[model samples]
Target: MSLTSAPGPGWLLFSFGMGLVSGSKCPHTCLCQTPEVICTGKQLAAYPPDIPLNTRRLYLDNNRITYLPAMNLGLLSDLVYLDCQNNLIREVMDYTFVGVFKLIYLDLSSNNLTLISPYSFSVLSNLVQLNISNNPHLSSLHKYTFANTSSLRYLDLRNTGLQILDHAAFHHLITLKTLYLSGNPWNCNCSLLDFSIYLIVSHLDQPGEGLTGS
Candidate 1:
């Protein structure tokens, strides 16, 4: 299926490494610079299906795109950096990134995301930096939600609707260094006892308030 429909009329195309000799294979709604394809602010309602598979970096920010169904990006095996922030995406189906295993940097902030199943990111064993903040509807979380974040170092969960957190969520994040949990309505209660203890002893650089006791 086509990733997305063309934006029509106005489009932008840039230069590549060896330079364009004759025809250009770039999409009509994006600017391709070889390894990097910038499709920002194109009013896209879905991902451009015609993107090159050899693309390493992709920018799809500031669009109206919604829904990242299963195997949506399965063809981009070489994709490393993906920026899908500031979109209208609601939920990320299972196996959405099935074949895009080389991804290490992902930005899903400023979207309408609500449900993030434990299996949404189960294949990103090499993910290092993840940003899922600014999503007001994303309230709950599960320990298995980060099943493959063993290589994760930076996690951003700021400005979310989180009210509680499980300690086991951080148990396997051995390499984690920075964790942002501010702007959440943390209910510092008995359920967070173990997590509170972890915050007191862990080497993570997490600075926030969690003593609501409500």
Candidate 2:
């Protein structure tokens, strides 16, 4: 008898084949698979693409994404790494990073962002390294932007096009050791003289490399 004559078995086989084909054609906007989660260069303009539930690493680089959705990112609970570089993101809305508590490293460089909202990174307590460099238009950071990020050690703000820093910009970052501000246009005037004095006194008390001017 021909395979088609076995109706029950043949129907089962056809359904299985269709499922396999569908699984093979995963959408270009997301890679919902094992081992690695690669979503780079997707050109996505929408928020929350269909990421895998078990995803550990996420790469959302080289897209046209301009804003993060207001909904909390609590679904990707297993995520450990995230890369959102080279996008057109201009502003980070409040509470935009909720539930991403396990992230260790974050890169938000090369974007059109002009400001970091106060308390923007407060909930990322486990974050160890952060890179926000090369954003030439970023000129200001709210006083409490890094207030609760106690575990942050390395902060990169190089070439950020800053002309002034408020006295409390780096407040509460007591654990911070290496700060990269090499290329910012820091204005060292009377308004900043107190902060400069504090740094000098603190540096002399600890006897380390001292501060420099523009």
Candidate 3:
């Protein structure tokens, strides 16, 4: 005689309100809006597990995701905008964003990345806009890779096949304001002479035009 134990207390409040309306719905192919969760180009290879855990903006663009293991987004720890553009990501292992530490706009453009493990932006220290531009087998860029992003402000390595770029690689980007090393192929020599004298003594913006030198 166990029909929920004799009609219990109103059937236990209608089965606890149907488990809170099935845990706040919206996830099967996503498109929620209570904190955004756009699931772009759903050709996703993974990661779409009933999102909506109070998601704070997440757009898995052009899916087919390849890899990003370490904690693998940990659980979108209150993420703040992330667009994995044209996926098929090759590598980015280290902590893999340690759970979006309140990420502020990041777009791994046209993936297939070569490598970027070391401190990978050191927990994104509240990162402010970054796009690993058109990664076509990204050549090299390991000088402490943005040195902890000190609140970075926009940086998009234009073409991404940068041959050599180690002049302290923007030494800690102390609030860097826009830096997009144009379509790379730059092998200027002398290790690019202190990054061309720190871009003419911090004049900054110069790395646009199709800079090719091999």
Which candidate number maximizes TM-score?
Answer: 1
Each model's lDDT comes to 0.77, 0.67, 0.73
lDDT of 2: 0.67
Which is superior by lDDT, 1 or 3?
1
Better of 2 and 3 by TM-score: 2
Instruction: Write one digit per residue (lDDT tens) for candidate 2, span 1-214.
Output: 2212322545445544544444233346677566356768877775444455456677778888887653324445566787878888888755566556787888888888897887678768888888898899998787777777888778787777876666576667667767676677777778778767655543322222223347
- Per-residue error at 213 for model 1, in Å? 8.5
The worst-scoring run of ten residues by lDDT in candidate 2 lies at: 203-212
Ranking of models by lDDT = 1, 3, 2
lDDT at position 13, candidate 3: 58
lDDT of 1 by residue, 36-151 (tens): 98999999998775677678998999999897643336556688999999999998755577667899999999999898877677778899999999998898887878866799
| Location of the lowest summed lDDT over 10 successive residues in candidate 3 | 1-10
Q: TM-score per candidate, in order?
A: 0.84, 0.75, 0.34
Q: Could you tell me the lDDT of residue 181 within candidate 1?
A: 83
Q: Model 3 residue 173 lDDT?
A: 79
Best by lDDT: 1
By the TM-score metric, which is better: model 1 or model 3?
A: 1
Which segments of candidate 1 are over 4 A away from where they belong? 1-25, 207-214
